[model samples]
Target chain A: MDGVLKIFKFELHNLSRSKWVILYAVFYFIITYGLFQFESSQSRVVVSLMNTTLLFIPLVSVVFGTMYLYHSREFIELLLSQPIQRTTIFWGLYMGITIPLSLGFVLGVGIPSVAYGMNKLEDVKVLGGLLTMGVFLTSIFVAFAFLLSIRHDDKMKGLGFSILVWFFFGVLYDALILTGSFVFADYPLEKAMLFLNFLNPIDIARTFLLLQLDISALMGYTGAVFSKFFGGWMGMTTALGVLVMWTLVPLLVALRIFRSKDF
Target chain B: MKSVINILLFSCFVLPLHAGEITVHPGDNLAAAITLAHAGDTILIRKGVYSGVGIVINKPLSLVGTGWPIIDGEGKGEIFTVMSDRVSFEGLEIAHAGLSYIKENAAIKVRDVRYCTIRNNRFRDNFFAIYVSNSHHSVIEDNLIFATVKRNTSTSGNGIHVWKSDSIRIVRNDITGHRDGIYFEFVREALISDNRSEDNLRYGLHFMFSDHCRYVRNTFRGNSSGVAVMYSKYVEMTENVFENNWGPASYGIMLKDINDSHIRGNRFANNTIGIFAEGCSRSMIERNDFADNGWALKIMANCDDNKIFKNNFIGNSFDVSTNSTFSYNTFENNYWSNYTGYDLDRDGIGDVPYRPVRLFSWITEHQPASLFLLRSFFVTVLDLAEAMIPVLTPAKLMDARPSMRRIL
Candidate 1:
C-alpha cells in the first residue's frame, strides 16, 4: 500500500510540473465561454458543451496522455526497478493522468456551466454530461496510452498508434457502421447499431447527454429504439453503466498488460 | 343562524370561479402584479415601455401583450425568470440585459416550465434573447429577436437558446444580427423548422451532441457561415436552403463529427464552399442542389463511406475537392453540368465515367494565388489531360453513373 501511494504521489507531482494541463484548461475555459457567448440562444449552451467535450476533450486526453506515457518511459522504467509492483506503477500513472485532466475539466468547463446553469435546472443535465464525459475520457485515454506504451519502445510510434486508435474509434468506426447500414438497408441492424454505438466513448457520452437534454428525437430511429429499451431513468442508468465500463475495461486491460511485461 | 348559512352558500356560488386577470399599463409594476395573480389567470399588458428588474412566473397563466409592450432590463441584471408550468408570454419586446460572462442572463427566460409558449415577441440587445432550460413540450414561435453585435473579445449572446429541454417546436422565428441564430444543447425530440436566420456573425443555427432532431425548411442565408451540425446522430435535414454565405473557410452548411444522419432535399448555393463535411459518416446526401460556388462540396479525406446520390451539381467552378481517393463513398445518378460524357448505349446513364473535380482545384486549395490562372490554356490542358489519363487525381473520384437529366 505504501509503495502504491509513493508511486501515486510521484506520478501526480510529475504531472503537475507539466505545462500542457494548465494550457488545456485555460484554453478550454476561454473557448467554452466564447462558444457559449456566440450562441444567442441559451439552450445552445448544453449542446455546445457536449460538442466541445466530445471533440476536444477526447483528442486532448488521448494526445496528452499518450505523449505523457512515452515521455515518461525512463521514469516508468525506473519505477519498475523499484520496490513497487508494476501494477501499482501503472495504476499510479493512470490515476495521475485522470485526476489532473478531470480537475482541469472541472475548473475549465464545469465552473462556467455551473455559473450559467444556476437559473436553468436543465443546465444540471449539461453539467452531468460534462463530468461523465470528462471522467470517462480520462480513464479511457490514460489506459490507451499505457497500452500503446507497452507495445513499442519508441515514443513517436506509440503516440502515433494512439492517434490511429482515436481515428479508428472517433472517425472510421462510424463511417464503417454507416457503410454497413447502407449496404444492408433492409436488414434488422438497428439493434446492432445500438450495440455498435457502445464501442466508442464519444457515442456513450452522446447518448447519455442527449437523453438528458431530452432531445432524443434528433437521434432519429437509433435514439427512438434506444429510448424504447433504455429511455427514462433506466436508459440513463444503462448509459452510465456503459460509461463506467468504458473506463474500467481499458484500465483493466492495461493493468494486465503492465503486470507481466518484461521491461 | 339560518340566514348566515344561506348567505355563505350564496357567496360560494356567486364568487368568480375562473382565474383572475391582471392588466399592466406603462408605469405599472409587472413583476409584483404577477405575484398577485392566481393560477390560470391572464396578465394583459397594454402598450408602452416598462423598464426594471426581471419577472419570474410560477403559475399556469396566459400573459398577453397588446401594442407590443417593452420590458427594458436597464442594465441591472438578468431578466424574465419563469419557473412555472404551462405559462405563456406573448407579443412583447424585451431588451437591454446586463452582461454576465459568469451567468447566462436573458431577456425572456423559461426555466423548468412545461407546456410554455413564448410567441410574437421581439428580444433585442440582450445577452441571451430567449432562454429555455429544463422545459418540455413547449412552443417558441413567431418571435423577432435582434442581438447586439459581438466584439472579437466580447462574449455576446445567442438569438434564441434552448438547453436541456425536450419536445420543443421552434418555428418561423426571425433571428438576425446575433452570434448564433438558434442554438440547442442537450435538447431532444425537437422540431426546428421553417425559420429564417440571416446576417449573424457566426452560424445561423448550431447544435452539438443533441439527438433525434429534425431541421427542415429553414433558410440560412448571408451569415458568417450557415448551419453547423456536430457530434450528434439520427438527424434529418430536409428542404433547407443554404445560400450566399461567402467568407474564407466558410460554407453554406458544415458538418463536423456527425454520424448516421440524413441530409436530403437541401440547396447549397453561391457560398465560398457549399458543404464542408469532416469526420462525418453514414449520412445520406440526396436530392440536393449545389450551384454557383467556389467549391460545391469539400469532403475532407478523413471521412469515409458517405453516399452522395441523385443530386444536381451545376455551375460550380469546382464540384468536389478532396485529398484521398473517394473510396468509401458512392456517388451515382448525379447530374454534373461540367460532365461531357457520351451515352452511345442510349441508356440514361453515361457510358464513360466523369470526374467531378479538376486537378487544378487541388492546386488552388493549396495555393490560393494560383486562382488567377484558372481560365489559362495551360490549366485547361492540364485538367483535360488529367481527366483523360487520371494520373494526378484518384481513379475512384469519378461519378460512374452520371445522369443526363437534372433530378430536382
Candidate 2:
C-alpha cells in the first residue's frame, strides 16, 4: 500500500510535467472562453461546449491513457523490481494516470464556464451535468484503453486498437443504433432505443447533456420518454451507476491481466 | 319657417334632461336602481360590496363604478345580464360568479346588444368574466381578469368569450389563469391588441371560424398552447410576442386550415414550436423573429402556396421541419443563423442556396424515437452527408437568397 502511494504521487508529478496535461487544459480554456465570448446566449454556448466534450474527451482520454502507459514502461518495470506487490503497482499507475487526465479536463472547462457568470440555477444544472458527463466519458474511455493496451504485446496493435475503440464508441456506435432503430422502426422502439443507448457510453453521456440543453426541441414522443427517465431520480442514479460500471469492469479485467503478465 | 327652425333647434340641441344620474349605495337594491333608471341614464355605483344575482339590465344605461366598487356575485348565477343596446359597464370589481355544468355563469353577460362597452374593471374567481354574444361594435378594454385553474379546463371559462359577434375590439387587457384568454367563434372584423395573456389552461387566444380578425402587439406567454387560429381566413397577427410556451403539443401559433393570412412582424421565442401550420394555405409569414424555438416552423404536408420570407431564424433547434418530402411553400430571403454558405459575390445573400429542412429533422419527424440521438456526432455526420446529397428532405424547400446577416 505504501509503495502504491509512492509510485502514484511520482507518476502523477511526472505526467503533469510532461506538458501534455497543461496543453490539454489550455486548449479547452481557449475554446470555452472563445465560445462564451462570441456566443452571448448561454444555451448555445453549452451546445458548443458539449460537442467539444463529447468528441474530444474520449479521443484524448483513450490515446493518452495508452500512450502514457507505454511511455512509462521502464519506470513501471523498475518499480516492479522492488519488494512491492503487483496489485499495488497496477492501482498506483491507474490512479496516477486517470487523476491527471480528468483533472486537466475539469480545470480546463470549469474555469471558463464559471468565469462567464454561469451562476443561474438552470445554467449551473446544465453545466454540472456536462462536466460530470465529461469526467465519466473520460474514465470510461481510459479504462477501455488500459484494457486494450494490456492485452496487446505490440505497440502498433495497441495504438491501433485504441483508435478503433475510440472511433467505434465515439462515432460508429450511434450509427449502428440509428440503423438498428430504423430496421425495427415498425416495432415499439422507444424503450428499445433507450436500451441501445445504455449500451453505448457515448450515447448515454450525450443523451444526458442533450436532454438539458435541447429540451425545447425534444418535447416530442422520444424526448418525453428520455426526459421522463433522465429527469427522474431513479434514472439519474442508474445512468451514473452504469457509467461507473463501465469504468470499473474494464479496469478490473485489465488489472487481472497485469497481475500475471510475463512482462 | 322661423317656428320650424325653433322646433328643430329644440329637438336637436336642447331638451328636457332625458339622461339623469342615479347613485346607489351598499344596501340599495341594484335591480331596483336599474328599474328606476331610464334609457340613456347613468347609474353611478358607489364604492361598496354589493351581493346581487341575475341582475338584468333591459334598457340602455351606463353602469359606472366611482371608486372601483366590488360587485360580489356570491357564487350564485349570472351577475349582470345586459340585454339592451348602448349599455356600458365600467370600473367595477366583479367577482365570484357561480359555476354550473349546464350554464356558463359569468360576471357580465351581454347578449343581443350593440355599442356595448366593458372597460377598466377587475374580475376575479369567475367562471367567465365577460361573455358577449350576438353583439356588435362592443369594446372590452383595460380590464384585469384572473381566475384559479381547476382540475380540468371544462370547469373554467375564458377571460373574454365572444360568440357570433362582429366588429368587436378587445384591447389593452391583462388576462391569466383561465381556459382561454380570449375565445372567438364566428366573430368577424375583430381587433385584439395591446393585451397580455398568460398562464391560461389552453390557449391565450383561440380563434375558430373567425375571419378578418387582427391581433397586434399582444404578449402571449406561458399559455399551455399559446394560440390557435383555426378555420379562419384573412387574419392578421403582427408584432405579437409569444414566449415560454413549451410542451409536447404547444406552439406560438397553431395554424389549422387558416388561409390567406398575414403573420408579420411577430416575435416567437422560447416556444416548443414557433408556428405549426397544418392544412393552411396562401398565408404570408414575413418579417418575424423566430428565436430559440424547438421547430421554428413545422409546416405539414397539406400546407401549400405559403410565402415565408424576411424572417430572422436565430438559435432555433430546427429552422424548418416538415412531415413529407414535398413542399409547396416558398422560403426565400430568410436570415438563418445556421447558414454556413459564403457570399462569394459580396451581396448580402449567400451564393449557396440554404436548405432549412435537414435530414435528421425529417428522420425525427417520421421516427420520433431518433430524437434520442439529438446532437450526437454521428447524427450530425449523417445530416452533413445528407446535406451534400439532396436526399431525405423536401428538395424544393430552400431559401434561394439567404441573408448573410440577421434581418433587422
Candidate 3:
C-alpha cells in the first residue's frame, strides 16, 4: 500500500507538469464557456455539454492513454527492475491519468455552471452526475487503452485499435441499436432495446443524465419501461453500480494482463 | 317635455309607495322576511353571520346586504336559489354549501330566471359558487369566489357555471381553486371579459357547444389543463393571456371540433402546448404570440382551411408537430425564431421556405422514450440529413413565406 501511494504521488507529479493535460483542461473550459454563452437555457447547455463530453472525453482518454503508455515503455521497463508490485504500478498509473482528467472536466464545465448561478441543489445534482459519468468514462477508457498497450507490441496498431473502440462505443453502437429496432419493428423489443442500451457505457451515461434532467420531451417518450426503471433511486443506484463495474472490469483485466506480460 | 317631466315625477313618487323595504337583523329569520316581502321590494340584512340552508326566493325582489352579511349553509344544501325573474343579489358573503354527487348543489343557484344580477358577492368553501341554469340575460360580475377544501375531479365544481343560458355577461370577477373557473355549455351570445381565473384543478375557462361568444382581456394562469374551446362556432377570442398552464396533457388553449372562429392577439406563454387544434376549420388565427412553450402549435391533420399567419413563435421546443403527412391548413408569413433561411432581397421575408416539423418529432410521436435522445448530436445530424432529403416527414408542410423578423 505504501509503495502504491508513493508510485501514485510520483505519477501525479509527472502528470501535473505535462502540457497536454493543461491544454486539455483549457480546451474544455473554452468549449463549455462557449456553450453557456451561446444558449441561455440551462438544460440546453447541459445537453450540449453532455454530448461533447460523451464524444470527446472517451476519444481523448483512449488516444492519450495509449500514446502515454507506448512512449513511457522504457520508463516502465526501468520500474520493472525495482522492488514494486505490478498492481501498485497499474493502480498508480490508472489513478494518475483518471484524476487529472476528471479534474479537467470539473474545472472546465463544472466551475462555469456554478459561476453562472447553478448553485441550486437540483443543479448541483445534475452537475455532479455529469462529472461523475465523465470520470467513470475516463477510467474505463484509460484502462482499456492500457490493456491494449500491454497486449500489443506495435504502437500504431494499439493506437488504431483504441480509436476504433471509442468509435464503436460512442457512435456506431447507437446506430446499430436504432437499425435493429427498425428491422424488428413487428416484434416487442422493449426488453431487448433496454438490454442493448446497457451494453454501451455512453448510453448508460446518457440515460442516467437524461433521467436527471427530467425534461418533458424526454419523459414523454413512449418507452415507459426505461423511464420506469431509471426514474427512481433504485434504478439510479443500479446504473451507477454498472458504471462502477465498467470501470473495474477493464482495470482488473489490464492488471492481469500486465502482471503476466514479459518485458 | 313638460308632460314627460310630470309623468317621471308622478312615477317616482308612486314607485316608492309600491316598493316597500324590510330590515332583518342577525337573529331574525331571513327566510321569513323574504316570504313577507312582495315583488319589487328590498330585503336588507345587517352585518352578522346568518345560519341558513336552501333559502329559496320565489318573488322578484332585491336581496341587499349592508357590510357583507354572511350566509352560512352549515354543509346542508344550496344556499340561495332564485326561482323568479328580475332578482338581484349583492354584498353578501356566502359559504359552506353542501356537496352532493346526486344534486348539483351550489352556494347560489339561479334557475329559469331572466334579467337577474348577481354582483359584489364573496363565496367560499362551496362546491359550486354560482350556477345559472336555464336562465337568460343574467349579469354575473364583480364577485370573488374561492374554495378552501381541495377536491378531486369527482367532488369539485366550477366557480361560475352557465348551462342552457343565453346573453349572459361574466365580467371583472376573481375566481380560484375550483374545478374550472368558468364553464359554459349550450350557451350562446355570451361575453366573458376582464376576469382573472387562476389555480384551478382543471381548465381556467371552458366552453362547449356555445356559439357567438366573445372572450376578451381575460387572464388565465396555473390551471391543470388551461382553457378549452370546443364544439363552438362564430366565437371571438381576443386580447386574452393564457400562461403557466403546464403538465403532460396541458395546453394554453385546446380547440376541438370548432369552426368559423377568430383567435387574435392572444399571448400564450410557458404552457406545455401553446395551442392544440383538432378537427377545427375555417378559423382565422392571427397576431398571437407563442413563447417558451413545449410545442407552440400542435395542429392535427384533421384540421383544414385554418389560416395561421402573422404569429410569433419564440423559444418553443417544437414549433409545430402533427401526426399525419397531409396538411391543408395554411401557415404563411409567420415569424419563427428557429428559421435559418436568409433574405437576400430584403423584403422582410425569407427567400427559402421553413419547415416547422422535424423528423425527431415524428419519431417521438411513435416512440415516446426516444425523447431522451432529444438535442443529441446524432439527432441533430439526423435532422439535417432528413432536411436534405424529405422522405419520412410531410413534404408539403412548409411555410412558403417565412417572415424575416418577428411580427409583434
Candidate 4:
C-alpha cells in the first residue's frame, strides 16, 4: 500500500508537469465558460456541455492514457527490478492517470459553472451530476486504454485500438442502436432498448445527465418503462453501478494482464 | 330649476311606487314570491339556504341577493329558468343541479330571453353552470363555475354553454373542471374577453359554426385538449394565452375548417401542438409567440392560403411540421431558434431557404416509437444529411425569408 501511494504520488507529479495536460485543462475551461456566457438558459448550457464532455473526454482519456502507458514502459521495467509488487504498480498507475484527469475535468467545468452562480438546489444537482458523469467517463475510458496498452506490444497498434474503441462507443454504438430499432420497428423494443443503453458508457452518461436536466422534450420521448426506471432513485443507483462496472472491469482485466506480462 | 326638482321627486317616489320591492326570507317560497311580484319589481332574497328545484321565473324582474344566498337544487332539476326578457339574476350561489341525458339542466338557464344579464354568481357541482339557448343581446359576466365530479366527455356538460345566441358578451368569468369551459354553437357576433378557463375535461373554449365572433385577452391553461375553433368564419382570436395543454392529442388552439379568420398577438407555450390548423383557409396568423411546445404549428394538407409570418418560434421540438406535399400557405420572416442557416449579407434574413419539416418528423408521423431517438446525435446527422438532399420531406415547405433574430 505504501509503495502504491509512493508510485501514485510520483505519477501525479509527472502528469502535472506535462504541458499537454495543462493545455487540455485550459481548453476545457474556456469552452465551458464560453458556453455559459453565450447561453443564459442553464438547460441548454447543460446539454451543450454534456455533448462536449461525451465526445472529447473519452477521446482525450483514451489517447492520453495509451501514450502515457507506452512511455512508462521503461519506468515500469525499472520499478519491477525494485521492491514493488505488480498489483501495487498497476493500481498506482491507474489511479495516477484517473485522478488527474478527473480533477482536470472538475476544475475545467465545475469552477466555471459555480462561478456563474449555479447555486440553486436544482442547478447544483445538475452540475454535480455532470461532473460525476465526466469523472466516471474519464476513469472508464482510461482503464480501457490501459487494458489495450498492456495487451498489445506495438505502441502504434495500442494507440490505434484505443481510438477505435472510442469511436465505436462514442459514435457508432448509437448508429447501431438506431438501425436495430428501425429494423425491429414492429417489435416491442422498449426493454431491449433499455438493456442496450446499459451496454454503452456514453449512453449511460447521457441518460444520467439528461434525467437530471429533466427537459420535457427528451422526457416525452423516453419510453414509459425507461422513464419509470430512470425517474427514481433506484434507477439512478443502478446506472451508477453500471458506470462503476464499466470503470472496474477493464481495470481489473488490465491488472491481470500486467501481472503475468514479460517486460 | 322648479322642473328639475319636480323631476327628481317624481323619479325617486314614483319609480318605487310603480316597481315594488318584495323581500323573501329563508322559509318563504321563492317561486311564490317571484310569481306574486310584478314586472320590473325587485325580489331581494335574504342570506340563507333555499332548497328549490325547477324555480321558474317567467316575469321580467330583478332577483337580487343581499349576501351570497345559497340556492340548492338538491340534484333534482334546473334551479332557475328565465323565460322572460329584461331579467337580471345576480349575487347567488347555485349548486347541485340534476344530471340528465335528456334534459339540459343547469344552475341557471336563459331560454329565448333578450336583454337579460346573469352576473356575480357562484356555481358549484352543477352539470351545467349557465345555459343560454336562442337568447339574444344577453350578458353573462363575473361568475365562478366549478364542477367537483370528474366525468367523461360524453357524460359532462360545459361551464357556460350558448346555443343560437346572438350578440352575447361573456366577460370576467373563471371556469374549471367541466367538459368544455365555454361552448358556443351557432352563436354569432359574440364577444368573449377577459375570462380564465382551465383544467377542463375537453376544450377550454369551443366554437362550432359561430360566425363574426371575437375573443381577446383570455387565458386557457392546463385543459385536457385546449381550445377548438371549428367551422367558424370571420373569427378574430387575439392576445389570448394558451399554455400547458400537454398530451398526445392536445393543442393550444385547433382551428378546423375555419375561414377568413385572424389569429394574432397570441402566446402559445408548453403545449403538445401550439397551433394546429386543418382545412383552414385565408387566415392570417401573425405576430404570435410559440415557445417550448412539442410542435409549434402542425398545419395540415387541407389548409390553404394562410399567411404565417413574423412569429417567434422558440425552444419548440419541431418548429413547424406538416403532412402536406403541396404548399399554399406562406411562411416568411418567422424567427426560428433552431435555424442554423446564416445571413451572410446581414439582411436579417437567411441566405438559404429554411425548411421547417424534417425527415425525423416524417418518420415520427409514420412510426411514433421513433420519437425515442429525439435529440440523438445520429438523428441530428440524419436530419443534416436529409437537409442536404431533400427526398422524404416536402420540397415546397420552406420558409423563403427566415428572420435571423427573434421578432418579439
Sorted into a CAPRI-style docking class, model 2 comes out as medium
What DockQ does each prediction reach against the true complex?
0.01, 0.67, 0.24, 0.28
User: Interface RMSD in Å per candidate, to 1 decimal?
Assistant: 18.7, 1.3, 3.5, 3.2
Give the per-residue lDDT digits (tens) of candidate 4, residues B1-408. 999999999999998787999998999998889889998999999999999799888889998988988999998889989999999988989999888899989999999889999999899989899999999999999999999786888778889999999999999999999899999999999999999999999999999999999999999999989899999999999999999886657889999999999999999998878998999999999999998787889899999999998998877778878886677899899988778899889999998888888888887776555565566666778898988888888888888899988886
What is the per-candidate TM-score for chain B?
Answer: 0.93, 0.97, 0.96, 0.95
Clashing pairs in 3: A221-B368, A221-B369, A222-B368, A222-B369, A223-B369
Which candidate's TM-score is highest? 2
Q: How should the candidates be ordered by DockQ, best one leading?
A: 2, 4, 3, 1
What TM-score do all the candidates reach, one by one?
0.58, 0.95, 0.88, 0.90
Q: Write the per-residue lDDT of candidate 4 for residues A183-252, one digit (tens) a residue.
A: 8888877778778889999888887775554333443433446566787789889999999999999999
Question: How good is the docking of model 3, by CAPRI class?
Answer: acceptable
User: Over the stretch B1-408, how does candidate 2's per-residue lDDT look in tens digits?
Assistant: 999999998877655467888999988998898988889999999999999789999999999998988999988888999999989988899998888889998999999989999989999989999999999999999999999746358889889999999999999999999999999999999999999999999999998999999999999999998899899999999999999888888999899999999999999998889999999999999999999898899999999999999999988889999988899999999999878799988889999899989888988887788888888898888888877776888888899999988887
By lDDT, rank the candidates, best first.
2, 4, 3, 1
lDDT of 1 by residue, A1-263 (tens): 66667777877777778877788788878877875676543544555566567666777788888888878878888887877777777777887887888888878876665666533665665576667777787777767777777767777898788888877766566556555655665676657767776777776776566555433121222334655655567766777788788778777877787888787
Model 2: share of real contacts kept: 0.72
Give the residue spans of candidate 2 off by over 4 A.
A1-5, A37-40, B1-16
